[model samples]
Every structure is written in C-alpha cells, then in structure tokens.
Target: MKDKLARNISIYRKEQGLTQEELAKLLGISFQAVSKWENAQTMPDITLLPALSTILEVSVDKLLGYVAQDKRITIYEDEYQTEDYYWGTEPNTACYQVLQLIPPTKPLKLLDIGCGEGKDAVFFARNGYEVDAFDVTNAGIEKTRRLADRTGVHVNVFKADLLEFRLDTHYDIIFSSGVLHYMKPEYRADIFDNYKRFTNENGMHVFNVFVNKPFIAPPPEKETNAYPWQSGQLLTYYHDWLIRDSAEIVFDCNSSGIPHQHAMTTMVAQKITTSP
Candidate 1:
C-alpha cells in the first residue's frame, strides 16, 4: 500500500504540473517532507492528506491506493455484455509479430494488459506461452474466461483498472493494444517504467496506441476517457531498449457503426540489458 501511495502521489503531482517545491508551498510544508512521502520513506500526516488530495485533484481514496467500488470508467462495459464478441475473437496481427520476433520455443510468461475479450491472450496461450490478462470491466473478464475455456486453454483472467494496477511480477512478453490511450499522458511515464522494470531481460513489449493526426479524424465512439497519444510518442519511452520494429499507420474503422479513419503507432521493442 505504501508503494502504491508513493507512486500515485508522484504520478498525480506530475499530472497537475506541480514540482515538489510548488506542491510543498501549496501545502505549507517543506519540499523535503513531500519528497519523503513520494519516496515511500515516510507517510504524510493524517491532517495533511485532505489538503494533499485537493491540491493533486485526486480523491483521498485514490491517494491511499483505493478505487471506488461503484465507479465504472470503461466505456466498453455495456458492449462487452452482448453475446457476440464486440471486438471479435480473432487475434490481432500484432500476435503474429510476436510469433515471428520471439517464437515461444521455450517456456515464456506473457501478460496482456487491458485485454478486451481475451482474443490475443487466448492466442498466446494456445501457442504455448503462459498467459495472464486483465481488463477494467467485469463483463470483459467473463468473456475472456468463456473464450479461453471454449478454446481448451487456460488463461489467468481478472479485472483491473489500468491506472491503479501495477505489475509486481516478471513477464517475458507484455502486450497491449488500442486500450493504452485510456491512460492520461502524465501517468504514462511511470507506468512504462514499471512495465520496463518488471520485464525479463530480452523480453519484448508489443504495443500500439491511437495517435492524433491532422489528416485523420477521430472515430465515431466519443469516449470521454480516451486520450490519443502524439505521433512517435510511444517510441520516446523505449529509447534505451532495442526497437525491433516501429511504424505509424492510418486505418479505416467502423467501431460505432460509422465509417471513420484513425492514425496509430505500433512498436515491438525488446529489453536488452547491455547496450544494443
């Protein structure tokens, strides 16, 4: 809990564009005290928490690493309840890239972050990669389990909010798809750091995010929580890692029963301990 609180404070502070000194000034405390709280070396005084929460624009519960039970942030929660798979059960083409780049000839652990309906997770499990996947919606979690069971493969599926969840265990391959754009821009750096830190040496990250472009317009789905990334933004985080492949593409979509176009960036980067 302490670790999560520390991380949330750091992330939210940066999100509000406040330096430690600035936050300290606002809270009538010393910067060192703020630093200590962010470092997880000490906890903020109970009296200070409410003020901290107000300044950071987050609730006290979130600051203390708790998500409200009644809150449902995902837009797909209702769509996922339908009998037919909303996004279809076919694995994304990125799964093939994973197979090509790092064939699972040996035992490998994989995690599907923001897994919607479990198509890619089931694909990896069928191909002999130990798979675990999560989504924010309970409906999505149930569908992933149903699909995995029908496919006769095991997938450790669960529900999680991407913002509140952090990887504590190691994985050889980590994959996320269109779901990453839900994260606010300020929170991405720390989230990526956690991901890169928990990945095994020589592990790969297969990810893609919808990118904002002048030529292409937004899709029909007006999702309040979605935040499209800037072009090339995803690659910026992998500067020290080995970039096996990267590309930006424009695609047609009919997600909300309307014809539209979107620009997206895709990357397959590998973690190499030594300079590559």
Candidate 2:
C-alpha cells in the first residue's frame, strides 16, 4: 500500500492553494524539503504526523494511512434501519460528502451504483441533476423506485451487478456508495479498472469503500478473518486511479447511545483533475 503522508500534505496544500514556499515557511521547513516530501523522496518524521493532519483538516489516522472497515455486527433490524434509514452514518454520509465535492448541478450526468433504497439517489435527483441509479437486489430496486415516486423525483433506477452491468455512454460523475467494500479485495480490482474506463476525461468519479482496520477475528473465523473487521463488515482498500484523494469509513457497532445498532464503514473519495 502507498504511504499517505506525502499525499495528505499534497491534498491540504492544494486545498489551501498554498505554494511550497508558503507552506514551508509555515512548517519551518525549507521549500526543497516540501518539494521532496511531496514527491515522496523522503517522508515526514513520526513527530510531524499530528501537525500534518491538523493542517490538512483530516484525522491523524487518515494522515498515517489508516483505513477503517465496517463489521456489520448489529442485529438485523437495527442494521437495516441504520443502512437504509439513517443518513448520519458513514455509509449514508459518504454519498452526502461526495455531493458536496462536485460542482453543483451544471447539467451533469450522475450514476449511483448499488443505490440501496435510492435515498441518496432521490436526494441527487431533486437537486436538479439527472441521475441513473442501480442495485443488485430486486427488493432494493423496488424500494428505490417507490421512494423515488413518493419523493416525486425523476430518477432512472436499474437492477444489475457490476460484473454484468454495461453502459453505452460515459458519465460526468459516476459514483458508488456503500457497495464496493462488501466484496473481497480481489473482486474490486476489476471494478476500479472499469470505473476508470467509463468516466470521461474531464469527468469525475467518486465512491466510498470500507478500509482495513487494525482488528480481526481469531483462527477458525472464516468469514471475518480475511478482511479488516469493523462493526460487522469486512474492510477493503481503494485509491485514486489518476489522483489521490481518499477518506475513511468507520462502522460503529457498539455506538455509545444505541446498543443494538450497527452500520457499515464509509470512505469518500474524489477524482482529481488538473486545471487548465
């Protein structure tokens, strides 16, 4: 896996539109050091990780390249309620954050892969962007459609799996939230490859994935052993195909306020484009 220190510095610097000289002057490092760090010629020392994360407005875990995973350990009902109903959780917030990243409307084409119940789909549709939503589950499709109807939003919902799904066109913004991390990591390689192929050059692609956490089950834990264990789901790693903007997903299985609820990890990412 790639180290995130340099990447974090780069993202923060770009966000603030700070030049190397400016950031270096602030960090008390030479401009050459900033350039070398950004280029990955050398790394920031462990002592600097906290300062870097604070300057970047991201958590130290993210700056240190830590990714979180969801464990999906909640009881069936609470899990369903959290996944389909609550927008505060990471899985739901993942899409919401992506929506904020994109330039508003501007007649863009959008896609929501694995759009369970179309909650985010409806939100995007009502915001005046044309949207196409897809899900692998039949019930999810039906529920998405019902929700779309009730919301009086015009969103085209489809039923298909990533392996079998095809499109005759590309999208300005193609995104999948709360879906990719469920599969084993090997299964995700092809999906990332396809995502790059289907996005236009000037277009952007964004998605959320559960990240690997520090903990996992013991031996004989067949299902959970292979991946990072979060509340109850397996964690996976993902990165920018062309650029490197990444975020984390943490599923809170044992939430302080709610004992019976569980949710999936949510990590948000955006494609980076160079301005002309």
Candidate 3:
C-alpha cells in the first residue's frame, strides 16, 4: 500500500503539472516531505490525505492501490456486450499446451489475465483446474460468467484494469493471451516481477504478446494503450527461469473487419527453485 501510494502521489502530481516543491507548498510542508512520500520512504499524515488527493485529483483508494471500479475502460467493452461472443468462445491453441505440460493430476490454481469473455477460464475450470479470471470490461466479465454458466462450470471472474491489478496470491499457472500488449511498456517490468514473485515454485507462465515486425502492418484497430514488443524482449525478463518453449509467428487478424497481419511471440516458462 505504501509503495502504491508513493507511486500514485508521484504519478498524479506530475500529471497535474505540479513539481514536488509546488505540491509541498500547497500542503504547507517541505519539498523533502513530498519527496519522501514519493520515494516510499515515509507516508503522509492521515489528516493530509484529503488535501493531497484533492490536489492530485485522484481518489484516496487509487492512491493506496485500491481500484475504485472499472468503467468503460477498453476498446472492446462495447463489442463484448452483445449476445455473440466478440472474440468467440474457443480457447486459444496455447491452452492445450498448458493441459499437456501441466496436466492437473491434482488441484492446481490458474489465473487468466485479461480473460476476454472467459472462454479459457471456463475451459480450465471444466478441466479440473481452479480458475480465477479478470478483465477490464464489465461486459466481458458478464459474458464470461454467462459462458461459464452455460458450460456448467464455475470460473471465478471479476473486472479489473491490467495496469492497476497486481497478484498477491500464489498460483500454479498464469496464462494470458492477446492481452499483454495493452500494458504500457513502462509498467511491464514491475507487473512481470509481481506476477513472477507470486507464482508457486515450478509454476508456469503461458503468455503471448504482439511483437513489432517490419514486414507486418499496423493492426487495424488503433489502440490508445497498445505497445507492441520487440522480438526477444520478453525472454530477457525470464533469464533466471527455465524457458520451456518459445516461438514467434505471423498471423492474420480481422477484428475490426479489416485485414491485417500481426507478429506475435508466445512463451511458456517455469519457475524452478534450486537447492542451496
């Protein structure tokens, strides 16, 4: 919470065009105090929260790393509202790899990051893995629940923004598909670290990211938040982990009814703990 508050203070303060000195002046404190708060060295007094939040134009909950609620946050929010599944209900081919690599001989916990419409989550749940899934869109969450209900499976689903959500619980597997690109490059390191830290020993992370290739044209849909990665960039973060599989592929997409090509990288990595 302290770390989140510190980061929020700095981020919001900068967004509001206020320097540390200016914020300190507004709060009737020394700039060093504001610096301390932003550096996570110390927290502000409870009494000063209101003024600070007001100045930063952010909710107190947000500053403390608690998301108030998800709104119409994604480009796909409206697309997910219809009776038909926008992305369809089929699980990605990569899901089968998960089943093969880490078959649930016993109960295993799996988390689906950005589980659009919950097809994969429900699939995992039906396959005997405990599944928890979240997406930024309310419609997506509803559709996911509907799919799970229709499939006679219970997929624990919720709504959360990828940028603000962090994992604090352990899981045997973490899976995400066609979503990591929505994460701003600046936050990838911290988010990946958080994901890696919370994974149980020998737990696997099956993830795919859209990567930039000179031959591939830009995606048809212009995303405000998309940052296509470079080749081999994702592997750098897993230097310590055993990389089970990694591949790059070029594929066609017709999401917005326009033909386009995308280069994507998929990686399956396992966290291994060695004896000292």
Predicted model with the maximum lDDT:
1
C-alpha RMSD by candidate, in order: 2.1, 16.7, 3.1
* Candidate 2: Cα lDDT at 192: 58
Question: In terms of TM-score, which candidate is stronger, 2 or 3?
Answer: 3
lDDT of 3 by residue, 1-276 (tens): 887788778767866889999999999999999999988999999999999989988788877768745245568987887899888888999999999999999999999999998888988998999999999888888999999999999998987778767787999999999999978776778789989999999899999999998887788787877777899999999999999999999988888998888899999999998853
lDDT of each: 0.90, 0.59, 0.89
TM-score of 1: 0.90
How many clashes in each candidate? Answer: 0, 10, 0
TM-score of each: 0.90, 0.53, 0.87
Q: lDDT tens digits, residues 1-276, model 1?
A: 788888788878987899999999999989999899889999898999999999998899978877633466877999999999999999999999999988899999999999989999999999999999999988999999999999999999987788768899999999999999999877888789999999999999999999898877767787888887898899999999999999998888888889899888999999999865
Off by over 4 Å in 3: 1-43, 54-57, 64-72
Worst 10 residues of 3 by lDDT: 65-74
lDDT of 3: 0.89
Question: Per-residue lDDT for 165 in model 2?
Answer: 48
Q: Write the per-residue lDDT of candidate 2 for residues 1-276, one digit (tens) a residue.
A: 133466556655765668889888877789998888877788877787677666766677745545321233212223234335433312355456556767555787889887876788888887777899886555566767777788888889976555334455677778776565444444445455556566765666666544444463232222342344343222233344343244343344433344332233443334444655
Clashing pairs in 2: 70-233, 71-230, 71-231, 71-232, 71-233, 72-231, 72-232, 72-233, 73-232, 249-266
Which sections of candidate 1 miss by over 4 Å?
68-71
Candidate 3 TM-score over all chains jointly: 0.87
